[model samples]
Target: MTSEELNSNTTSKTQDNALGPAVQLTDEELSANPEYVLEQTLSTILSRPVVCDEESDVDQETNALFTDDDDGDNADGNQRTSNENNRHKQSDSPQTGLSRWKPTLHKPAPSIYILCSLMSVKVLAENLVLGVITDLTLAKIQKYYEDNERQSQKEFAKFQSVTSVIQGLLGISLCSKYGHLSDNHGRVFVLQICGLLTILGSLANLYIYKDSTTYEFYSFVFFYCIEALNAGQMSMVAVGNSYVSDIVSEDNRMVCISFFMSIMYATIGIGPLVGSFLVKIFKGNSFNTLYVALFLNVSYTLGVEFFLSESRTVNERRESQSQYHNEVLRKNLRKEQAIFSKESSKWSKVYHLLKMDTLIDLFKPLKTLWVPKTALGSLVPRINVLILVIIEMFVGGSVEGSVQAIVTYSMFKYSWSSVEIGYYYSISGVGRALVLLLAVPQLISFLKRRNYVALPDSIDRIDMIHLYLFLIFVITAFASMIVYETNDIGSYLNSLFISLSAFALPTVQNGVIKYASKKSIGQVFAAMAVLRHLMSLIAPPLYLQVYAATAKTFPTLFLYIPIILSALSLVLLQFVKIVKDHDMLRRQSEASFNNFDEHINNYSVNTKPNTSFDIANNLKNGKSNLQSNSIPIETTPLFKKSHFTGKDNIRNSYKSLRNSFVNSNTPSSKNSSLDKLKAQNFSAFNVPPSV
Candidate 1:
């Protein structure tokens, strides 16, 4: 018999024996098999495929549950058969054809080396000029006061305090602004803008340092104000860290962070040596470091502008901007509807939009810290995130507060020159680099492999350990400085050999970021930056003032502040809780299920047109060729075979279904089934009910 005759005969046999069978099938099986009488009836009525969990194959199904398997080796045979079947199906799919045409236009992402290099250069440049700023200010103070030592120290302290205050106030807004901007525009855009600001700040530094004799002390203040613009180093660190977070997965985030931080520490160690060398090259001119800094800034800025690509994708930018605009539109509509129902004045609308409440809304980014619950109202304890942020801010500010104080203190106590300060930082930098590059990674690996530390808890545990080690070393160093009248700089550098605490910054950041979503990362970092800047604004002046007051009688008294801050941070550290990796996976699954529910209300299937048979004529003639000899046209499945599949396809399918339903001229009775399908509970698709 011909193929068409044989297919029709087989289909007729299945339909005729449907009632006489000893075993029975449910409505779902009857609806799924096109050869079944019930499916034919339903398809004839609706001319649409019924939604089912899977297609039923009745040919291989047996009434007997117990089958004679050749010593259970048949199971292996069946598994092999299934694998072969899958391979055949994959071979027959259009994916094979599509896979052949690989796109050559695709470019590899820029190396992490570039980012590391950029950060190192930036750090080195800043370090090179760090001592110059203070020294120049002191020089101007001395020139003004005719070498009056006590008055010069007092003025220098005030200058430091005023600089911190101005920088802190401006930095908070700038960091917040750049964080939002990076989300919308791109990371590279923020990086480039911040780089240019750094360049300008460097130029201002060079100009001021070159003419300290010609200009007054206010020039240094102007330079410091310029440094605060666009958040300066704060913006760079936040945005750079954000970029690293974007490219690396959570699993390797710590390692990547450690890698870059090691580079930063290395530069910190080397920068002073280079700066002192350059000063000597110019015959003891501290201003020479400013020239090198300017050069490095220009080079790095150009490299960033030309070589670096935006980390945020086009789709992400569109989605983020869309949500923002939609939110604004919604708020405007609500306000107009509520207050301006009778009033048609434009000024009223503008005033309502630009009120003080709206101004206060700018700080809404800080809400990332207190993520009280998920979208579905599941409680997510993120208090640890807040704790980590406070710890970082307090610790970072305290560390920064030590720099100027230590610089001046060493100058007064040890009679150290600018070159000696350079050597001191260089040694400390080497110690820190060794810890981050070698010790941190090894310890993490050892814990994960040997101790079987859970990945989520590992970071928290390691961070705490590092913090403890840092605090211990810091306390010991300060105690020796205060208790013993240590005149030797070597002893100070020797005490800092335990710079293993250098791992604390990156690890703390890594742990805090575990609680953030991909979209909110920038805002979270920005909020942290704001807090750090606030501390910077507060801590420096306090340290400087205390040092100035005690410089004559008790120079070591200023060392107590960092020890206090470190102790407080360690106390807070004990309260932080670890979020397990599996819990994160569960949250992701819940999010995906939520998305599916949102899309399934309008779910659709797109059927391919059959060239051999007419779908339109089959409907019109009250017939279906799905069980006929003619090739059956297949409907495209909801989610096809793609590793990167997501909700975009679901949304598109929903739109297609809606359009087809609206444009169809079918009878209302036939369309009723489609409407019923839309209204059916998600359980119909065998999807588990959400919690």
Candidate 2:
């Protein structure tokens, strides 16, 4: 038979009644005619509905799958019945295929992986380019000094110090601003801006050192300015962390962040190898690295624009914008209604510009680190936030200083080339990355499985332990460096120790998140970025200058800086406390109680009286009996309306009254309940005393 004829016959039989038996097609006809076979197969498959756990999304797919036929009311009824059957089946089975994958697309794993890939590529490119630039700069300075060792070294140190200061100064404001913007706009938005800036900086770097015959020191400094405009490297770190925070829940945030951080460090380790290979291929030319860096930056920016979804929802963005605008309006209104007169002259304007308040405005972003008083009026959150900030500063400074001190010290003392220095950093990076990736997650999982660190309180304590261990490792490593100059073996041990200290920042961040609200995550990380830039400003000058001055006498004197910072951090970590959000707990309890009360009230009001109960009949008799009383019921105090102070009391009173009425209607109890009811007070129920 023809395919059309076969399909028409099958539809006619099926549409007569949906409850009818199936029409079986002959196997020979199904096999012999491809058209009929295909039609029958599709009809069978489409007739059976696609079932999934997520009914809402899957229902859309199911609707789109079915095509309507123009055959009349019978066909329409059959189609409707089929849809209903599909829905029923969907309710029974779990979701599969694309629908299942869609739910997890927004989950933490995919987000972390995306972020890691983006950051690793960016870091890898950066390390390659930056290493080449540093070597080129050193070579250029050596020429100006005519190969004078001390003079070239001093110039390089000064160059490093100046660039760091400039980057820090710009980064302080930019990082905080970008962070605030990310909270309102989106994390991906900030990342895109930073990525574009990074690409520009790479282009500028290429232009500055395009020619081997001349070096543009001023131009190179401007290049640093461009990078620092988006808070330099720290901006990416802050935004990336905030992005992770947006996706991951508090329970798993620490582990995910550590893993994220580990990936970045792992990239740091791997970047050098890639960079060195590039340098080797280009025959010692570093300029090619900039091209590669620029390419990576462009690719990353495009990826972010296309692939990454915004973490903040439309409602969240709107709410954040509303709050921000309202705050700005309030501030503006306050300024307009000033208690003091406005400045009337240029001198006054100058005075205003130099005012302490004006200076304080520059540091206003740091206020985010101080937890504001909530409705609960708790001091613990504020204290914990402060402690976390303090720990971050000390620990962050030490870490930053150690990086500079170690690199400069290695370069000068061991006379290591750029490649050798890269190798050293790579070794440390690998060690850190492995521990954070492999060990940290397993440890967290083990603890969770054992039920040791279950709640936020327990998590806080674990963070403290991690911090303590990190500080101990840092102290031991740096202190050992102070005692004896590091050889290859010493460097290996030091890297191992430093690698173990990787737990500090991630743990400290977890603590910070615990104290801060979810909305303020961007601001919190921005404040952290600010602190890191502040360290960058202070650390480079202090460590590099100290190393420059004492290189010949005691190069290891700068090592003391990190040791001191770590020691101070270790001491301050003791003051950190774990406090639950009492306000949130109280709100949750009150809401639960209200929900229960509402349910009980709804039950009491809507429940119908059963014909088996004689309460309705009794009410009529009691009313008539009361009306016939010789003493009027109007003057009786028991008949007056009363207010119930407690809902619980009202509910209990109603339940008791209901039970008494039910018992009074029964043949087994009969008048026994009536006597008890007469003795019982009904004032709590706002009814007259029982008759």
Candidate 3:
């Protein structure tokens, strides 16, 4: 029997079994011919286990039985085949093949890597310099006030508090402005400049103090500027962070940023402790220690310029070359085509590209608490920013306040000399350094892994973790303060807890800031600077007010502010949940789009014309027109149509299944889709044949 005849008999039997009866329709019988119709009905229904060319042909008797209406349907079948061939030709066009060359992931040059590393070093150096300067200057100023005995103790105390307030305000302003500047210019360039300024400022302060005996207005201005410069050093760190974001992929960014931040905070902790010990070695001449800080800053600046290469390539250069080549090629190809006399000017194109209106729209984040959802409809990225701001504000403010308070408290209460305060701060610095160098980096790495595995969808887990850590430090610090106030805890324990809190505070603050800054380095840093400054503005007054209010009964009135702040921080933690949920959904949507785009790209690239039909005809006719070396065409199934009836239902069902899976997965939903798809398909195919 022929292939057509065998196909007809099989179709008749299959139809008989499925529908319980078979009618004698000529069109149906013709479609049953295996050679002409290719088992159209069954191929359409089953849509799987497709037969290739090598498969055995249907029996001849089946073909004869289905030959009644073959002549009439022949023209229609040929037309359908021609239309499909046309579509296949279009699908195989060069335009479709061009889709293969999509934007692939590119790694930044080695110089960028070197610059990033140097930036990390600069962060450490600046923190160290700040610690050394603050400790030394405060010590000298306090001693001078004491020697003169010009003012009463209460007045001196108030004066010192006022100095702190002024310093905090100035620090906030400088840091915020520089942070914005670093966003505009390259991070390395701005950082190098900042480092140089720090070195100069430190040296100038050192030189002026050595010869000056009288306290003058210039002295305060000089130191104030120095303090401002010190605060502005943070901008350098911000610039480094922005660079990291620019270089790293989204998948690997968190780990790299977390490592950088951990190192930065670790240095913050160690700087003071090292400075204090150094102060003891230098005796009472704390001013001399400025030289060492100056050296570190200058060295870091020089190292950056010499070793670090610029990460940002000029867009104008790339655009000019691309446009030149494209225009030349186009002109060559279409010599007869008239060029437009008035094409839009380049400046106009640039103006439109700049989108000043859209740029202005971004400013809303600064003024408002509400975060805009990204294209993927996820709020996680924005929530991550908010959480960072909150975490930095409370924790950053506390650390700055506590550090100042410790210096003042040691001087007034313990009667420790400049050397003693420096020594204590240096020890605290060592603890901080250890955390940054060893403990914090490891902790950040672990947290990041947990974030990827457990909360892969959420971008703000790191921020949330930071908030929790900040709360722990705040509560512990407040409790220690309370104990000290009530005379229930020893001075040793109080000092130990205070030092520990200071060390831990920066870790939490840096972690959150680094995490948020991972995506848009400059913007996040700018926003953080604004928040930190706001905190600085509030912290001094709030501390003073609380101190004044509780001073009559409790000597440690500063303790209450932390408790209030800590409680407020906990409230902020609730928002983290909202942000995280939004981010996860956004990521899933983005991943889905990316996968779809990739599939389309792959399909477009791989599609080609099937020349096998022409070759087969040539072979049958004994013609020699075909090329002997031509690549073999891959055979595709003749019938492409399948039962699309349940597609929408399947999608809906799958969506529902995915939702359940996500809910059950909780912290980690990474594998839920694969598991759900497999389970659904397995159960679907495993069902027994219908009776």
Candidate 4:
């Protein structure tokens, strides 16, 4: 038979069956079929045939279960099958042709690398001229002091030192703002604007370079502060981490985070080397080198604008859906030649932007960070995760503050030069890159394989095991620092240990981040940055003061402070209550009766589609179909499908007579007998019930 005829016959046979309405595909069989449906839907949408990946067939089978249609219909086996066929018919839709909007980077890797590189370049450039700018500013500020050279330079140096920490604190303080901007506007937009601001600030610094007056110096400082305050870098980190998390669902999050972080860490290491090389090339002409870096920074901004795609979840999808809906409505209205009425006006739209609804959305990240309950009244890890994150940040910050102290220790103890100091700083960068590339991934793999670590993504909870790992690294770092020596090998070994000890910090950072509500990742990171920045403010001054007092006499005593702080953080982790997301509670609420709630909801919606109309039409059709196909037969000789049993044997003796009457169909006599038999049956007389 022809394909059309074959399909029609199959449909007719199934539809006309006696139990057609009651029959259903078994769950296992039904489960096997959604890929065929999703493949059809995507084919319709993208205008290209997409076979669901072979390895993911099992996973994609469940994907359709989660994906509901625009009209909120959760497709079932029969509905999905029908929808697939319908989509096949409409595959020629013009929306499917997207050649004009083709993206440059078809994969995640290139985009991630470029973004990380841009950030790396920015920080690298800034660090290169930071010292020259500081010294120049100190010279400018020296005029206010009446004391001799020693007093003027000393006070200015301390003040200038404060600027670095101040820049950090201010930048960290604005992480939240830029994070909001990233989410509301776009990550790349945040990058571009912030990069431009930095460039402008750098230019301002250049123009005011020779100004020995206090006002111009402060103006330069203020502009530079503006540059740091809008720290596009930290915002990018949060956004980039989130973006990578979204794209890579493979082997948990370690692979994606590890690779991206590795490249980023390597750039940071290479930056100093580049900066030192540039320093030599410029031969004390810091301004010339600064100008070159500024140019590259601008170029990076342009690259960000043109090349990087926005990584926000809600903004991108919501805007696209809105546009698509409008396009569809416009097309339909045009075809019908109907008036395309506008909703309210542009003024009302503008006014709505000021409404409380917009305000609530603006503060949703805050709510997600501070509030315990989520929008669905589900539990979130607002308190516990924040506490742990704070601890991590404090410990990290205290350790970070030890940088200058270590430099002091190196200089006073080992007599290291400027170039040697740069090399020393680069050691940590190398160590960090090594950890990112090797240690983090291996550790995660070890823990997961052993099943000691909870699945962070699935449960949305931080495992204490991660905390314990962080502790191990911290202790190891402390041990390495305790072994600090004046020799080159000992110094390098100390640096290596410091790096190894920090192996778990980034993992813990990513871990605590996961523990937070996915909706508030940016805000959580902001809070984290603030705590770190706050620590930076506290520890640097403290470390510097302590080092200045004791470095020549007892340099290693300074190292003990971080070790103690690390130990305290480890103890604090024990108190941190690791709250999981409500995923488990939700699962428990649903698992009984094998998804009964979902089934009931689906059934209610299915049975009540335009309740009155559907009830009337569907019931009538159901009744008719049930009635026609469900006629019962009597155990008589005329009914060949029936067999004689009990009273049927006796009835069979009279079957020939009954058949003679039934065959003749004398209307008056036969109709009454048939009607009586259909109405009721008795054991005394062999009578059949109605169908």
Top-lDDT candidate index: 2
Go through the candidates in order and give each one's C-alpha lDDT.
Answer: 0.59, 0.62, 0.47, 0.51
The best-first sequence of candidates by lDDT reads 2, 1, 4, 3
**Mind giving the per-residue lDDT tens digits that candidate 2 earns over 1-691?**
6556866865654432122223333434333443332233223323322212222323232222222333334445655676687666543322222223444343333377888888777777777666677887888788867899998898888888788677778888687678778877778778778788888888777766666546456766776568667677677888888889888887888888889888888887787678878989989877787888889988887676656766776445544555566666765554444424464555544554455444554466687778755434446667777877776776667766667667767776678786676566777889889888987788778766766563453236667668788888888877766566756455556667888778877887777777665666888888888888887777666777888898888778877777787778777777665555443322111221122122222221122222312222322333333344321233222211221223233234433443433333222232333254555543211222121
Tally clashing residue pairs in candidate 2.
1
Question: In candidate 4, which residue pairs clash?
Answer: none
* Residues 430-487 of candidate 4: C-alpha lDDT, one tens digit per residue: 7778877887677667766776545553222234655566566665665665664646
Ten-residue stretch with the least lDDT total in model 1: 57-66
lDDT of 4 at 310: 56
Give candidate 2's whole-model lDDT: 0.62
Error of 1 at 142 (Å): 6.0
What's the residue-level lDDT of 489 in candidate 2? 51
Each candidate's TM vs. the true structure? Answer: 0.64, 0.66, 0.53, 0.59
| Stretches of candidate 1 exceeding 4 Å from the true structure | 1-108, 133-159, 206-220, 284-290, 327-364, 374-380, 402-420, 451-498, 544-574, 579-581, 584-691
lDDT of 1: 0.59
* RMSD of each candidate relative to the true structure: 15.0, 17.6, 18.6, 18.1
Q: How badly does each model clash, as a count of residue pairs? A: 0, 1, 24, 0
Question: What TM-score should be assigned to candidate 2?
Answer: 0.66
- Residue-level lDDT of model 3, residues 85-135, one tens digit each, is 645643333111112353322324534447645655655555655655555
Best by TM-score: 2
